[model samples]
Each structure stands twice: as C-alpha cells, then as structure tokens.
Target: MDTCKNCGKPLENPDQELCPACRAVENAKARTRREEKAGHARRRRMNRTTRKMLIAVCVLAVVFTGLCVTATVMYDKYNPDEFIASVDAALEAGDARALKNLLKGEDLTVSDEGAAALCRAFTDAAQREALRGQLEDQVVDGGAQGAFPALGVEKESVFFGYSRYSLTVHSVRLLLSSPVQNLRLSLDGVPRTGEQTADGILYQNLFPGLYTCTVTGTTAAGQAVEGDATDLALLSSVEPTVFSGALPIADITVSGCVNDGAVITVDGAAVEQKPVNGVVTLPQVAVGSTIGMQYTAPWGAVTTASVQFADKTVTTLAFENPVTEGGVPAAGELNTLLTAHYAAYLDALNNQDTALISGCTEEYKAALAQGVVSDTHKANLYVMGTAECNPAAIKSTAADGTARVSCYVKLTYTHSDRESHEETPATAYRVYTFTWADGWKVSASADSTEEAYNTASMDALP
Candidate 1:
C-alpha cells in the first residue's frame, strides 16, 4: 500500500479505491462548478438590466401623462377668453352662429351699471341682448371690464372739484366701454346733479373753495361709472377729493345664550327671551348704518356684536319662537286638545305660518302682555276635536288687582311627520301657572330643549 512493490506504481487501499483516471474526473468536476458559477453571475447581471429598462419605460409614461394634464388645464382657462374674441369677430363679420354659441354660457346678472352701458352701446333689444350676454358672461378677472365684468371702457373722467379749481383727471386703467354707456352724474352733499350726457362735462357755477364731489352715474348696460372730482377754480385747478359710497344699511341685531332668570337689553330697551340659546333680534335698522349691540349672558357673562352693518337697504326684526318647558309655546298645552291644535298647526305649516292655539280670556291677556300676540298679528287658534284643558287643575286668580289663581299646569307637547312640519309627537314637559286675569303664564319649568327641537317638526315624522 505504501509503495509499488514492482514498477514503482502508486498503490491504493480498499477505502481509496480510485486510480489517476478517477483523480482526473474529480478535477473536471471542479471545472464544471466554476463554469456554473459564471453562468449564474451572467444571468444576475441580465436581470438587473431588464429591471432598469422597465423603470425607464414607467418614467416616460409618467412624463407623458403630466404633459397631457397641463395641456387640459391651460385649455379650460383660455376657452372663455377665446370665446369673447370670437364674439367680437362675429359681430364685425355678422356671423350669427358664433354669437349664439357665445351666449350659451351666460349667467344673467341684471346690474344697473350693465343696463346703462347696454343702452349706450346698442339701439334695440337685440343689440342690447347680445351685449347683455357679454356682460353676464363677464368675470371679475380679465381686468374689471374683461370677461365676467365685461363693461369695458378705456377712459372715464368726472369734471368737478374744490376751490381754486376742484377737479379730477381720471387715468383710466381697465375702463372698457366705448365713450362709456349709461352716463350718470351724482354730486355728494349737493342738492342738484349736472345734466345727463355722454360727453363728460359737468358745469356748476357755485362759489367754490375746496369741496369733494363724486360723479356717480352708471354705464348704459348698468355698470357703475365714477368721475373723480377734478378741482375747478374759475381760473385755477386743485386736485379733487375722492369719496366712495357704501351700500346702504337696512337692519341689525344682537343675540346670545342664557340659562334661567337672565334679562337681555338692546340699547337700554328690555328684550325678553326664554332660557336656552337666547337670541335677541333687533328691529328696523336703516340700511348702511353700522349698529352696535351688547349682550349680557347668564351669570353676567356678556358678548357685544361689533358695529354690525347691513347693505340690503331695509331690515326688520325676526324672532325665533321663545323656548318653553314644552320647547315651543304651541306644542305644550292640552293633550285632549292635541287633535285640534295639531290640525291648526298643520294648516299653518302648509301655509308657512305659525298656529295660535288658546283664545281663552285669561290666556289671551297673558299672551298679549308676554308679547306672544300683537294687534298686527293674525291669530290662528287650534280647533279642538276632543282635546281639552283640564279646567279643574288650572284655576285663575286676579293679578294687578284683577284677582288671580296660580297652579302648576303640565303641558305635554308631541310632534309627528309631514302632516306636522313642526312639533314632533315626542312628549316634552312644560309648567304653566295661571293667574286670575293672566290665565296661563310660565312660572317654573324644564328647559324647552332646542337641541332636538329642529327634529320636532311634523314634517320629520313617519
């Protein structure tokens, strides 16, 4: 085993049975493993290349999509401007279809400035209508008289001013009307205005120091036109003082929330409210007047609405129904009277009004004093089918020397659906105390919760 006994041949034992031939085979096997490793590495590199190509294609797709979106947004923004230009071209060329297409997107806004401007621009309704379409389609952008606000004028001026020579020379920026339409001349603090004319010359012969004048007349289609007061002295000129008028104030009010036993006052006048989100509504405010209001909440917590102003020219007092132990005053009274009250309330709801239930003398007096009913208010009482007030439980005594009675009257209010736009059939409790002459007045009661009150309407029930 250790050496070749004859011819120097290498010897192998039983455990090492292979010869040189077998050794060569083992070497070839090692070569095969190396070749397989190289092939695996090549495949890995190929896979990486494939992944990069996929990524590149996706990036290109994203870029293409982004460009498409940008193009769409640009198209929408410019379409309206393009339409306006087309309308102008059609007017010049007498192309009816082009004008008709442009008119389709109009949203009508009948401004006085627009009416005046139209009158100036066109001779008849057809011409005016076409321009009206233009005005309606106009936008606030596009430089005042552009697009949505299309009362276009290039130059506008108002000739007036203080002493020396009160006057203003208007350097128009976005004015678009040709010679401008609907010329109006209003002088501030002055009793009279200059004659109406397309030519912007106002002549006032009054002795002048320095005075502010506002020439406000609108264009024909009704766009507002202002002429800056140019100071005109008989022999000199001063810069005109400018003043801007605000829309008139019509009404204003103050309101707040409260618990029990809190009083509300408006400008020192006592206003009444029931506990639970108490709101005080003021009546008869002049348009354009900035109103001041102060509210004292429960426990002396207070809120004051700042100089609140309105512009709609007229304002009136609006009262939300006083919250009662039975929520609203109407639904709390008689269970037996529910059918009658329900019908009356239903009729009122149908007509968009409130129903008045009780008409008894004592209750009437209480209602009147409490401001529940007034002479100007039309009363709609509930007609009783079978419902009755337990007269025995409620006894009246006089008050203010009229004699009286005071007792707790439980008023359970309920409301149900469409037949009942308000007043859900759900029961709420109220305490009613009657005095001899005052009939039934609220003494002590549970909070007429308004949280679920909006849901109490008959219109909401099944």
Candidate 2:
C-alpha cells in the first residue's frame, strides 16, 4: 500500500509518492508561503511611505514653531503698548542706563541724578497718565508733537511686515548766568565748556532733562567760592532756559583817601575792617549791595555818597579839607552868616534905609544906596517882605577869605506909585560873593541864571 508521506494518510493508487490529500496540503502550504512573501513586500513599501510622511510632518511642525516665535517677537518689538510698557518699567525702576538704551539720539547721555529726577516727575498719577496719552497719540495720529517736541517716535520695518519702534530724543540749548564773573560750571559731574555772550553763558546741544549745576569761581577779593543748584530743569528746545545766582563777593577800592581812617559801611552797617592802601576787600559784601565810606576830617566827619558795589572797581572818597591856613570860617559858620545877610538885605530894600545894610561890604553898601536913591527918584517905593536863604546853596569857599553863595529869595512887596499901588510877589535866584572882613559880609550880588542856580543847588550838601 502507498502511504501518504506528509500526513501518513493511506493511498488508494499504487506507485504514488504521497497520498492525494497530502499533495493537496503541500500545494496549499506553498500558496500560503507565496502570499505571505508578497504581503511582506507590501508591508515594507507602506512602512517607507509612512516614514517619509512622518518626516514631512516633523519638518512642518518645526517650521511652524519658528514662524510662531518670529511673529511673536515682531509683535512685541513693534507693538506700541509693549514699547510703552518697557519705558514705564525703566522710569519706575529709575534705571538711567536702561532709559538711555531705550532712547534713540545722536550723542545722547543721561546722568543718574537727572534720570532720577525725571522718574520723580513722572511718578505722579496724573502726569503719568498724561504722558501715556501723549506718547500714544504721537505714535498713532502724529499729533501732540508740541507736548514734547524734543522727543518723538520713530518706526522701522522688520521681516514679514513687522515693525520696530523707538523713542527719539533731541538736544536743547541751556543758558546760564551769574553775577560772579569767570565762573567755571559743571553739569551732572561733567565739566561743561560754554561760550560767553552778552546775555549769558551759552551751552548748546544739551540734552533736555534735570541737571545738578555746580559753579566755582574766584571772588573779587581773590577768594575761591563754590555754589550749586539742584534739580534745574532744562526741558525746552524752543527757547533757551536761564539760571542766574548771586555768588560773588565784590571788593571796593576807596581811592583818594589820606589813610586807613575811613570806615566802610555796607547797607547802613559799619564794617569792622578799615581800608588798607585804599583797598577794602569786603568778603561779606555781596555784589549790587550799597556801600559808602565815612571819614573824620579836620573840621568834622563827612560821609561819601552811597554807591552800588561793583567788582574790582574804585570808588573815590576824596575829603577836601574845608579849613585852610588862613582864618577862613568853617562851612557851618559861613552858611549861617550868609543866611542872615540875605534877611538883612531884604529888610534894607523894604525900608529904603542904608542902616539895615550893615551886613554888606562898604562897596556893596554904596551900590545898594545908589539903587535905593534911583528908585526913590522914580517915585517907586519898594517895600519888601519875607526873605529866605538855603544854607546848602554854598558853592565853594576859598582860603582868600572869599565864598560863593546861592540864595533863593521869596519876596512880597508893595510897589506904590502916584497912579496906583500894587502888592507884588516875586521869586529870585541870586548869587552872592561874601568876603570875610572882620566877619562875614556880602561883597557882591548878582542875578543868577537858571542853569547856574541848578548847578549850585545840586552841588549843595545835605
């Protein structure tokens, strides 16, 4: 019997290698193997396609992430709100370096004190709100330019239609002045060289901000002095800002003085120090203060007129000795005698009597006598009243026993004629020459011009 070799099944036919069922089983097994190999090839092709698809997906994901990051960065850099927030942070922190980095300008700098002051100024709620509004308006509508004209907003384009915005600042002019000349100035610990002008010291291209100004100079007395002004705001570009301070002490030279006997008085207070070599170094006396000198003369003490203290200038306090070698009367005695002489002269004219003219010299008496006689011949009786003389009108006194005096006479007189008698009032300015003959006597009298009267009146002393 032929047995099936594969499965040991019985064979019906002879000379068969295997049973029929066994052969069928082998054929089915072979078909199954071919199908499995084809399936495996299909699976390998599918896996390669899947791997390529995965790689493309990963590449797309990475690209999408990069684009997202770039978009976010552009948005933050160009966003007005974000820009403003950065500035607000810097100001709140009072970080001068950060603020300077955020600003865009040529040759711009910020000092720590200046930045701190700026931060303080913006710390107010209302001011911060106003600033925010102004910055926003400047960025959006281009309005509010005048609010901070020196400051502005600039924009630049980046990738993918994005923009970067920055704040631009410009410099302004600062003008400083002081009564102290030759002043060396510094701002924010930095030495500043300035141009001298008629108005003041001009500093150009200075940043607009608060500054600590320091001034140093030598006074008129050759003493070093220093002064400082804090929080000096110079935030305008349209007009120059000015700062003036009084810091210099002035020395006054009292020339024409005989010795150091003159006492210096400033603003009515006598100084303890006296003049040395006619030079008075008034360290405590400020410029523009009133200063005067008082000296004791041979006859009396005299005070010079008060003058405004100027830097390194000479003021003459010349005291002319009123008393000379001759027996000239003192100024006070001469003034009194001249006043009385004018009174007697008016009385003599009114009474038509030469006896009352005893104060006049013999030559003047003869002249007055002739005038009285001439008036009597004309039938004009001149009756005079009230005469006054100003003692300050003494022009000068000479060692030759002669003195010039100006008299202002107010007279009320009755001019009686045969036709009519009239009471008349008259004012006269007369210059008289008085000679010391035994005593003070009026030697000559003449009507004075108005100009001469004014000059003599102005020359009079108090």
Candidate 3:
C-alpha cells in the first residue's frame, strides 16, 4: 500500500497506504480544504458582481444629476416673469433696439423710425403697466386680452419639457381721403405715400398708437394748404383706419344758365362783377361759402338757392328761372303746353281718340296715334298726372333758337284689368325741346339725364 504523502495514513489492505483511523482523519482534512477552496471562489465571484453593480449605480446617479441640473437651467432661462421684466426694462429705458429684438412675428419688418414711435407710445407709466398686464394675462389665460392688445402669444421652442414664449406684433393700415390734390401725409413725423384705391388712398404697414397726423396739399387753384389732426389713434388690426382732411378751398363750376344777364354770387355777394357765361369756373372758393346766381329781369330780381362749398372737387350750381310777377313767358308757355298735352295724351290712350293729342310734334302725334290703335284691344289704360317743371333746373336756349327744358312729372292714376282696378303713382323726369316754328311747340322729348331734376323735390317743382 502507498502511504499518504503528507498525512502518513495506514492502508486498509495490502494496496492501501494508511490505517483506517488515520485514513478517516486525512479524508476529513482533504474535504475541509476542498470546501474552503470552493468558499473562496464563491467569495471572489460575489466580489466581482458587487463591484459591477456599484459602478452601474454610480453612472446612473451622475446621469440623473446632470439631467436635473440641465432642466433647472432651462426653466430659469424661459421663465415668463423674467422675460416680462426684461421687456419692462427696455421700455423704461426707451430702448427701441431692445424692444425690436423682443418683438417677434411672421413677415415682421420694423423700421428705425417706426420702432421709435412704438417706444414713445408706451413711455407713459400707465401704458407700460397696461402692456405688462396684457402679457401677464396671456400667460395666465393662455389668450390675448386688454385694450392695447397684442397679436397673440407664440411658443417659440421647447427644452427639457420647458417652453419659451414670444409676444407677437402687427402693423396697422390707414385709409385717407382728401379733396386736396397732391396730398402729403405724415404720421408722427414719418412721411408716408399711400396707394390710390377706389374709395380713397391706402397707407399700409403703420404702427398702431396715438399719432399726430399732418397733411399738406395743393388746391385746384394752386394754393398751398396744410392741416393737422392730433391724437389720431390707430389701434385696431382688422380694418384700415380712416382719416379725412378739412381743406380750405374747393373748385366750383356754375351751370344751368345761358342768360348773359346772370351774375355769380358767393355768400349773397356777387363774386363776378360782369355777367357769367353759361358754364363758369369759380376757382378756389372758400369752404363753407354759399354759392348762387342772380338774374335781374325787367320785372323783379330772382336768385337761386345757394349751395355750400364742401369736399367736392367740382360742384355744379344750377341757375333757376322761377315764376316771378312778370318774368319771361317761356316758362308759362311750356307749362300750359305740357298741361294740355298730358290731358290730351290720357284722353287719347283711354278713349282711342288720337286727334285729342295736340301741342306735340307731327312725328310725336303719329307715334301716339299708332300706340293708341295698337293698345285698343288690350286692357283700358288710364293715365293722369301733374306736369311741373323744376324751378331750380336748367332752362337753356341753343344758338339755333331751340329751347331745352327739364321737368318732373308725377303721375297718380288708375288702370282697369279684367278682374281688378289698380292705382299706381309713378314719376318721370323728361327733357322737352321747344321750337318757334309755329309757336312754343315741343318738337322732341326724351327722358332727362339731368342730376338736378332727379334730386329736386315735388315742392321745388312748379
């Protein structure tokens, strides 16, 4: 038997190296060594795993700390109160460049002058407070509000779940109308040339605020005039603000009279010493001055009602030949002819008697006769009206001795159908041309396009 090298144990048989008791003790020692070795290996592996877990936890802690720090810094940067404070500081210092930088919008272009005007608008303490309140309200309510309202609040960017806000601004437009020509308009010392439109001139991209509006222009008579409207506020962004200038002078045209004896008068005083032509130009008449015409006949003097000079560039003054005590017989003769002709025309239409129509030209009579014959088979059409010439309308005589007269005819009559009778009131403005061949007889007649006739009331007609 072989003996144990270190323990010296006895063998149990011939091939054994040690005795039984000694062998048992040696086996126990060997088992103890093996168990100790295995325990050491387990301790080493556990040490390695613990080290790895500690390293991972350290990395995670560092990363979380960094993220929290970055989040805090971003929150500070985008703080709404701080942002509002910066804007208030710029406003207090009247720093236009700073304010311009703070303002943001789409397609927003602000000039140096416009920015300066904006700064001036909010220089007052009350205005600044109001603006600050609007900004704060936007933050709280998430909408725009207040008198001096902003366009809206905008979210510019986000960082770490933090959002940045920006206040937006918009430019206003102004619509201006002026009777003065070559108009020069300025707002707060900024010159503006507006585009011409159908309604008026349009000045675009103006800053909204209280401004001193200055306007200058050249009158039709080459007169220089200027006007100023202070504290003209343009705050709305929806519609174009309108401004009008009160000019000093206006251009006037006198018409409706061909009589060489008629005199043009202004404010009850004669403007022209000599007789005025049929159509005369009274340049640079003072605004608010009443213009009229005076015609002194052999019997009495007649003056047309005066009209005031206002914003109109060109005004027409109609000369009237009202019925005086013993004035011209042309008006009376025309009235008599129209009264009889109207009666005869109605009789011819209702009774089918074409011969009743007189005081008309031969062609007109023939036309009436044809119409009466054609309408005989239709419903009974009755016509009755009062024919009165406008007293303030034109009564001009051509060089060929033909006279033109405009009159307003009001018709109130009844017509009968097969079932019912209806009475209708109608109005007609007609121009009658008279010739002196046989007498003052109407040679032609048509609808009047005269503006004076259309505007004249029944009380003004005779």
Candidate 1: where is the Cα deviation over 4 Å? 1-43, 81-125, 128-192, 195-462
Note the clash tally of each candidate. 90, 0, 8
Residue 191 lDDT in candidate 3: 83
lDDT of each: 0.37, 0.63, 0.66
Q: Write the per-residue lDDT of candidate 1 for residues 1-462, one digit (tens) a residue.
A: 544443344656534444556657778999999999999999999988798888999999999998788667655544444444554555455444443333311223333332322223333347545543543334323233322222331212222211111011111111111234443433334544433324333443322222334444432223344555643212112222222222121224434333333454433344443334444444433333333334332212233333333445334333333332211123334343334434454344334443343323443434334333433323332222333233334433322223322222233334334344444333442323322223323232223333323333322211
lDDT of 2 by residue, 191-297 (tens): 89989999888888887666777777754434456764655666666778787633545444545333467776766778776777755656635655666666553
Cα lDDT, model 2, residue 78: 77
TM-score of predicted structure 3:
0.43
Task: Give, for candidate 3, the lowest lDDT window spanning 10 residues.
Answer: 397-406
Q: What TM-score does each of the candidates earn?
A: 0.18, 0.47, 0.43
Candidate 3 lDDT for residue 376? 57
Candidate 3: count of backbone clashes, pairs at least 3 residues apart or interchain? 8
For residue 321, give model 2's deviation from the true position in Å. 28
Q: List per-candidate RMSD values in Å.
A: 37.3, 15.8, 23.9
- Kindly give the stretch of ten consecutive residues in candidate 2 with the minimal lDDT sum: 316-325
Ten-residue region with minimum lDDT total, candidate 1: 162-171
